[model samples]
Target: MKNNINIPKEKLNQAVSRGIEKGRQEKPMKIRNSSMIIKRVASVVVIGGISLGLTFPVVVQAFPNIESAIIDFVESVLPKSYSNKLKHESKKNNIVISDGKAIVTLENSTLDNYQFIANMIIESDFFKQYEESDLEHNLYANLEVSIGDNKNIVGWGAHIRKIDDNKASLVVTADVGDIKLEDNVDVYIKLQGLEIQSNEWKSNDIKELKGNWDFSFKTDKVESIKRINIKDEIELDGKTMTLESIEVTPLASYIKLTADENISDKWVFASYKIVDNNGKAYRNAQIDGHTDEKAWNFTIAIYDDLSNIESLKITPYTDEQSIPSKIHGQDIIKMTTTMDEGSEVEDIIVSRPVEKRDLNVDAKPAHKYEGEKISYNLNIDKEKKFYTIDELIGKSINTGDGTSVTIKDITVNDKNTTIMLKVNGDYNVLSQVVLFDEDMRDIYSGIYVTHKGKWPSNSHWNNAKDTHYASGLATFIIDKIDVNKKYKLAVPIQKEINLNSGHTMNINLK
Candidate 1:
């Protein structure tokens, strides 16, 4: 196996600081030096805890069986939940892209069913000065990622932390596209351009820097992600709910759920809740899904510990008001887990829901928002307004200033209209592009703000070149929208766009 990124020789003490995970006792953070930076993104903070309840003494385990040496990276940035699985694994790369002014090298790398990830080490004296600059927003990486000849699996990169004074580590993750990797597949990355921003990270981007960094190599290794068989059907308020098997890794748990066939395009669901048999509550569900005319499948990832969990008590909720057994919902699903006596540390097992359970939360709800990783509290419209997903579906408005907002996905329940809005181009100008009613009021129950998007490939690429992007979710009042009528959208900040609706006018979509 040819390594594309190589770690430079250095003492272990020359490392950067990482934020500690809340509420968990974690082992010491390790550092490893290496090469390259970005198809990067929002900072992904891994959440997990150490249970110390292992039935037996366990040594630090690797993914197992593979021969590629798990080099001590410049920083072992793997999430605590997955630290055991990925701690010792890293791709030793030798390919370096340098334009004489800067360098990008691929270092620690791993793969799963979702995408490929690599730690990119970058060293540049000029760029390192941004850490002390008066500007809060200084740099951005524009990259293109490809996997085994896929037409468009462009990846995203992110800045993890500043290491030594001359170096910083970046992580780039690319979607797997429709193709599947078997034994081995070649991967490629290109740093098309480097951008700069003077305002907030969401501000307009200016491509002021240029560099040539490209690396590619082939390897047969993949992170050990396991799927256990779990099949059960339960009846929800009005639809059929099926519980599929869960995908487990040292990083997190992906719980698979399916709704009844041909459910309406817009639907309602009880917010889900899960707890360990020990009464430890798991809140804040992160959701991803597939939607079509006949199928609606969802994968919910729980970023926490799953070991020592004799069983899991799963419950569904509409909101916090109906909590602690006053649930108009059904019983919790008590699931049994399985594992070989001595499997690899990465090989965790979770069995099917063996029986129904009743979980009661004793404390007040601690989690704020549920779906998207929102930063602030959105004021709920309070009115139980409903809207169909088709009202303004697929509509978009692009300003001449390079700022645009697209209506990505929408779901309506008896209580609110949740819209997934994708903002592209200039980030600072997002406050100007507002969704409104005929009266031009910013009608929303609560506004879910988004910044880095956690770099999930769930948004659109517009079949265009790489640039800065952000997204959000907003819930609205008004029982439903009149899909039969035209809707007005505004970009009030860009008044120079010359609109017929006057200076405060909005772009109308029929």
Candidate 2:
């Protein structure tokens, strides 16, 4: 009506429909733009809130709880070995994580029942990993115990920590007994750390451990001991006795002996042939005592018949001696002798001297007598003593006459090389006679003369003229000469002899 124009109904309707469709599209665009702007603002707020939570101290503190809960859960679920490994790493790195804790204690109702006691504590962390790649951590405690009683019996107590797959910490304590011992004893331990997986968190952190121990006993039948060595002041009496070399057959039966050196001089020893129950003498063995410092040792051979020997008797050499000389055991016996007081031994002796004889010597010249015809006779006597001619002859001489004299002998005093000679009639009277070897060089001259024989009186002759010479009556004792060599004696006599009308000069050597 307003258009007043008959615009067709289809055209009007079409325009209206197109306009609605366009409005619908435009509305959706406006809604989309508004939604995007609202979404971006919400995202910024969410990011700011997360950042604030991280920076706040209260929020950080809250996180530790969560971490501790997670570590505890993991420790409860992990294996003990695995938990221990994580504990060690955390300690080395100075790291504190949420891990479970363990505590151990040792208790005694009566403190007097224990003799010695000790306490020990340890702290460690625990951790574990699961089959699904999950991890957990924990802590634990252990206790060790050692106890001794009046009966000389010992007891031990130990608590072990174990982590299971459920992340649970299992504590187990074991009490063991029947430890009967008379002396000291020791225990060895091996420890390691590791991680394992379970249902809850568990800590391998081993904390408070009680290692305190106690020992107590009454000093009842304990045998007192003293060491002794005996080496000197003892002797063995037998056909053949070895002092230190002898030994007892079964060594375990012999008890170590004891003595004091200050008192050892009073100790003595004696041995006897042991007799068996069968009346047969045991091996003729003997025992010797030896003392090294304050101890005594006895050496005895194995008795051939030890089984039959019944008893051995021992008595000190003196009642005042404090040392016990007799050691008695089954089938074995030892005896000690007594030292005599103020006993002394004498010194040794020496021998006397013998006398030697002196040698005798004599010398004389030739003589001439007047009668129908005269001859010289020289007599010599040795004064009943051992004498040599070289001791009387002195030396060699050379005269102006063309003659040389040498004294020599093929053998002298049983020696072949020594020679002795004398010349009376001389071409040249040799003032000095040189004794020589085969080479003719001088060997001995001064105080060495050549002659052969023995005289009764060298200083006093009974049957000789005023001028008488004996050339052959001298003897020589030679020393150190060769046996296979030959020698010669050369004598140069005067070419002429002067005789009176009825007198002739003669020279004789005897």
Candidate 3:
């Protein structure tokens, strides 16, 4: 939620100096949540890297250059675009703190406009009691951070793992609000508590540690955020949604779109799928977007480098089959280190990342919705056949293009309205669901869950039948819908195919 002005492309190549939490949420989350654990909208996000410092750090009289800054984390944890941005911002630090019982080190750190990661290692005799079997041990440390003279208290989240009986590694990430990296950036961390967790035993905790781990280090100021102005429009829920601008950086691209008529109130998360010219697809976990609701601006963070992208095929997708439910696969990561003789442990290799694309280009999506509509002109009166919400539960409506939906149930509560539906026929992706009032104001209902019908276990998208996964539950926020006013349920003639011809805009970066 830092200042976003959509700087003009001609005036942009300069460094972007603010700090942002690198996750897809409505805004940058502060670190005070359960110490440093940050939550993302699409997936659970944590920082990366490991650090070990046996002694207090001295100003590395000779600062380590970019090549030696443990840049491997960028390659491993981040998308290519993010790694590229953070790789330059990384600075090596060996700050150490100990309170007789345990020790922690701030080994390496990086900061840019989008986010920051602090690589740390904590060692204590206190952890020796927890024995490791075939299972892995994890130690989560609750830490808080602050940046520069602004005393901006940042939020943090950690990914911690026990490396040895007495040692553990952690990647601490957080959001430093409105701080400029060009200034003398000083970072302070207060180590609060440590939790020991594993499959076999109850978690144990060590509360409130003594001396803090405060460190100050400077990084190269070379963040290049590429801004491109675009004026492409796509129809969403019977309205024109404009793709206004896109700002690309190594960390992530900030894509701004304006929804017609200020959709701020009825907005659900913008679901967009991206395919590069290489046919490499990027979606789900790597993409996160939010709307500030002012001027109807929606900003999406696509964690990839799009500055010089020769061409792109981007679309607002609603099909469950199009977006991944969770992270799928990983790449082989090997970490090699050189050490002197007799050191307890000299090297560690930890791997984490993504997965496969497609069996073949000819493969079609498993479930996709055809252009369809729900009659918006119907009045909800008890005298009408499908007038009452409860009366419509067992009713079936055909979408004309070989798709139909049967309502299993509809739940109305104070918070939201939930409709359980069974989709019948070919159109498995049920288009965009909405609730329309007599005045024709559309309220988008979010489909939170989709249960695919039973099918062969290994069936890919190409061979999957429409009936394989035919039903889903979509919910709309129309708390206790006004009974006096007439409203109708609808599937707003959504297109699942990639926007083609006039609907899509091609950007040639040459």
Top candidate by lDDT = 3
C-alpha lDDT score of every prediction, in listed order = 0.38, 0.23, 0.43
TM-score per prediction, in order, is 0.44, 0.13, 0.46
Writing each residue's lDDT as its tens digit, candidate 1 over 1-510 gives 011222331321122111001101011111111112111111122221111111111111211111122222211233433334333434445345666667555644555554456656565654545541222234556666666753344333343333444555555644342246765777777665555454322346453456668777774445546676566555554666566667665446667666665544332334444556565544333333444355456555565556556666455443322111111122211111111223222311111111111011221221321222312111122231223336456655443234445665544443323344454432222322223444323322222222233222211111111112211222122223334333344332221222211111111111
lDDT of 3 by residue, 128-159 (tens): 66532212233456666665543566655565
Model 2 RMSD vs true structure: 57.4
Model 1 misses residue 404 by how many Å? 38
Candidate 2: 10-residue stretch with minimal lDDT: 41-50
Over the stretch 333-439, how does candidate 2's per-residue lDDT look in tens digits?
11111112232322111111111101121123211111111111111111212113332233232211232222333233332123333332212222212223343
Q: Which residue ranges in model 3 land beyond 4 Å of their true spot?
A: 1-45, 52-75, 79-90, 129-138, 146-151, 154-156, 175-186, 197-220, 231-235, 238-244, 250-253, 257-267, 283-299, 302-308, 322-508
Off-target runs (Cα >4 Å) in candidate 2 are 1-260, 263-266, 273-288, 314-510
